[model samples]
Target: MTAPKPRGGDILAIAAQNKVNWSGLDQTCINAIRVLTIDAVQKANSGHCGLPMAMAPVGYLLYTRFMRHNPKNPEWFGRDRFVLSAGHGSMLLYSLLYLTGYDVSLDDIKQFRQLGSKTPGHPEYGVTEGVETTTGPLGQGFGNGVGMAIAAKHLEARFERDKSGLFDHRIFGICSDGDLMEGVASEAASIAGHLGLGNIIYIYDDNHVTIDGHTELSFDEDVCKRFDAYKWHTQVVEDANDLTALSKAIEKAIKETSRPSLIRVRSIIGYGSPHKQGTSAAHSNPLGVEEVKLTKEFYGYPTEPPFFVADDVLAHFHECVERGEDLEHAWNAKFAAYSKKNPAEAAEFQAALATDLPTGWDAELPVFTPKDSLATRVSASQAEAAIGKKVWNLFGGSADLNESTFTDVKDGGDFERGHFEGRNPHFGIREHGMCAILNGIAVHGGFIPYGSSFLCFTDYARPSIRLAAMMELQVVFVFTHDSIGVGEDGPTHEPIEHLSSLRAIPHLTVIRPGDANEAVEAWRTVMTHTHGPVLLALSRQKVPTLDRTKMAPASGVRRGAYVLTESAGRPPEIILIGSGSELSLVVDAKAKLEEKGKSVRVVSMPSENIFEKQDQDYRDSVLPPGIRRRLAVEAGAPMSWYRWVGLDGEIIGMTTFGASGKYEEVMKHFGFSVDNVVERALKLLAR
Candidate 1:
């Protein structure tokens, strides 16, 4: 094969890069993949066909030879992970899953992009049996692979000391031009290189065709040089069809046990399509019936039967089923032997795999008192350190905000290149990549992953955060400096609407603790949460811890909201609600209101998301139906409080960006003061 002209920098060539002959069976299987992909897109009438057509050889080679995955048991603990980073080319994954004997059937392929089908337009994690993580919004899967690699490294360090090879699986993926162009992927790639995650190996399909036309229309960076600069092992393959070259590249990548690998392969977009071979037309649109027939003729395939699979091809692919079973059986035996020698470690590993917290995992959790006046972020840090000691499976770090976010686990060592045994991972300043990586870690299992940053910076990580909620991963997202309380940093650092915006995402639990004790309870809830992602928006300024002896216990935080102090001798004539740092205002205001001979109730509502999940009777009990004279106070957008506070009620919140000053000054400026709360409640009661 002739080499393409070198782009910007010197091409990093691989060893043993020579022409290796292919048999009829290999060629037939590769074409079967191509044929099935095109047929699926053609039938669906809406999907990308070009990538599958172009990268069939690499996909076939990886599944058939390189990857140690069991088709029969997609969730086999010892199986290697395969991420389809170029999720737009989803047909490539579905076809492979179907062919390799994963639960995906030919009928599933025909149902591509159809409602309720396992084969969605993009690869969804739980929807498909084999898909490792959800991918589609370009570069997310790339970051996810890095996370999986990190998980593998950590697990291997913890459990593979006996050389049982139980946790030594690698992460393989196929990425497209769009993926590399995305900032998330770039950030993830840089970190992967920095950490020297050798278990990750991704093949870049340099087809040069995107939905907008050729990649040259915009992207023209020297990808190999860039990766090399990131400290990754890079290589170039002139032809995607050169299976031998692809094989050798993968072999070299596997042997380079210190750095991640990116093999860039140049190939035609729509490999066999005669008319639109290298153009954007083939990138997303289906190959028309006539053109498909012409493409099939090019592959020496029968044109009459679309989605046809030869007997030899099926026979060849089904081998993975038996091979996978044997692989699992062997690993089971090794695990049994390891268990005999190390029963405690074996049980711990098993418990982690089952996502079961150990006995007394919460035994050491911090319990705060009214005397502990501290920032919620500080309390959260104490809670994490205590939990981190017992729940060894809880692993994560902040995105260059460790000090600010107060997410450091006390004695937990840093997770670095050579020290994968550490539980704390320094995610640098890459919030976008950090959240996506956290999702990857959560999906990989064996760990309850979390990532932190200032609440305002959730904008950088929103896409991944949304996906985490969508996938229903049990991830804890800790965001500190949650409001204008991040004073002097001004509006850019203060998260004015962040709480409301995060609450908008379905299945995402947003918790902003009212005080130190509540912060500890919030962490308790976070550790026990299993359904979906949870975001903890903690305070940068200290909050007076409510005296549980005089008020409702902090355990009420688990129920999401509770009445802190109830009215005496009557049902409340006026109700006061607050969350996070503003809870103090309502507490103070309640005393002032009672002095006016009004029956007042003060409720500390930390998490509206969790409260809404309670049954009607419970919800009504917290915010009584008769009490329309209610006032809600928070240092954030009032949008989220509308449901809790009736139309007759009022909210003390920031309507404009906060000014740079002391936190107290900022709060007073934004009308988040006790006087404001008292005034609002009086007016509502008068009405």
Candidate 2:
């Protein structure tokens, strides 16, 4: 592997000018990114080398020339967001972070893909300084980018005055074929187009290669055409190697303020590799010592040097860091002047960024007594309207189910292209896009966002949900018409596996409240817990509020699961457990069993996930180990109840799809009734 002959300075000049050296300065910086990516992957012995090698020029042009960000204050609200949606090429992002003087260092790069290191195999939000969102799952980053774009537009609308572009910022993402192929991206793209989010720009690395040799093996759809179908503005760069073309394409994208832009950049997978430039081998595995050496030598890098940075190249890259800081500082000064000029606007801006809930925010959460009757969905809407009034930053929309889900913010106007200041978002029938954009809004930082649709429709947003959990984003998903109670909508609308399935995700909390009061409690719980995403599954049918005087207080709802009712004496002959609508059944069953000379206790288990998080003493207090004769009941699948019900327990739940009928008739047909609950409890006690 011999160095290419000098084309333009010293040894550094020779390496930088190899090819595509449009600007000597730009060339040095681009090569610095390329070499850093190669060396990082080579040192770590793991990582995808193809994307970083191929997409370095685009990334270089964006970060160094276009994107406005501060390396020093990574959390700066005014900085433009850059998401590497093709997270497999994390090395590319990490390399840029290291060179452009973000908090990431050469040592951090050395620790790539290692456990406990900030530089993981993929970009992780909150884990690394500059990582916008976690993007290991394909297409999730693109969806998140949509969310960020929405955030930028909304913030700019709310805060940016005519003379002062106070909240102006752009969201940039690098997506691969995998991102375009994923359904979440399509859903998010459609919504982005509909919303006219011009602040967003996505660069597609059209390498046409996947893990399975070639993308042609399975993927052949025209991505540009598809984006066009979604009503997005599109452009194609004939060569990824051409920096000038990439720069001009980005400028055009920035110029268009009516639509989001996608720049399809064509390039080889492993740009400078000697043997595996366009093959599957370059996708994940190392390029090997000989091939890597040859690639570095071919680009005029010193053979003996590893992780080497030429002073001039380092100087050129540091300019980005300086420029980023200056941008932030300039914004800060402008913001300070704006605050003096318009105290009211400045206060609103500061208040939103503070993450503080408005005073008396909880005043609107209607308190329900045992005598009240209401559906959890209705109760949730009441709570939402109350919170929405106090927390002005809270914004969201439903998937054309606002009336059904009760998710509309009262008096809040729709978020349109021209009206970003609106609190309510009309997402139409796009559940997937609603979830993705909620994540984007949350990622944008100032707004507390939520998305709503039927519980069954959660399937449409599953990928986005998974990404939200992975990113530990604080986006809320309000899923109404939970369980068979969705009724006349029939089997098609009912959510049989969704509750258990969403619970299966690692960092997501799935909560289903039993009544109006518990629904309020569920809302309170979701607001207080900020570590990850929360899914609120609400019922469509009215449920009687649990009698607080006769039962445990609604406060225990925060415990996930708790003893809603206690036995008359020391320990009960049998324990009855239920969640959501079925909790009412257990409450009624407890009365009949007690009348029949059986000591019975009913526990309202709203959230199994949160219950599991409690300490054993608390859990034991709720469900004592001595009580083996327990019966768990729910309207949906029964698979999740075994952990609480014990070895001798029985779960009276739906093992099949629901029937078409009224909600009450459906419940009766499914055996989700007091009679069935009493029978199950008696059988357990008899045993």
lDDT winner: 1
Candidate 2 residue 140 C-alpha distance from true site, Å = 1.0
| Clashing residue pairs in candidate 1 (N, C-alpha, C atoms within 3 angstroms) | none
Question: lDDT tens digits, residues 474-573, model 1?
Answer: 9999999999988999888999888999999998999999998888899899988998999999999988988888898889999999889977898889
Task: Report clashes for each candidate as comma-separated counts.
Answer: 0, 2
For residues 1-687, what per-residue lDDT tens digits would candidate 2 score against the true structure? 443332212422322233474867676677667777787788889889889988889888888889998888889988989999999999999989888889998888889888899899999888999998888788788888988888778777777776687676889999999988887788788888988899889999988788987788999888889889888999988668788778889999999889999999876777778677777788998888888888887666665577788888877788887898889889989999988888987887787777667677787688998678999999988988888888877788888888888888888888887788787888878787778778877877887889899999988888888878887877789999899998898999999988888898999999999988899999888877777898999999999987787778887889999888866775688889889988898889888988898888788889998999999999998898998899988888887888888798999888899988999989988898889888877777777
Residue 240 shift from truth in candidate 2, angstroms:
1.4
Taken over the whole model, the C-alpha lDDT of each candidate is 0.88, 0.84
**Residues forming the 10-long window of minimal summed lDDT in candidate 2:** 6-15
* lDDT measured at residue 345 in model 2 versus the true structure, 0 to 100: 74
Off by over 4 Å in 2: 1-21, 369-371, 567-570
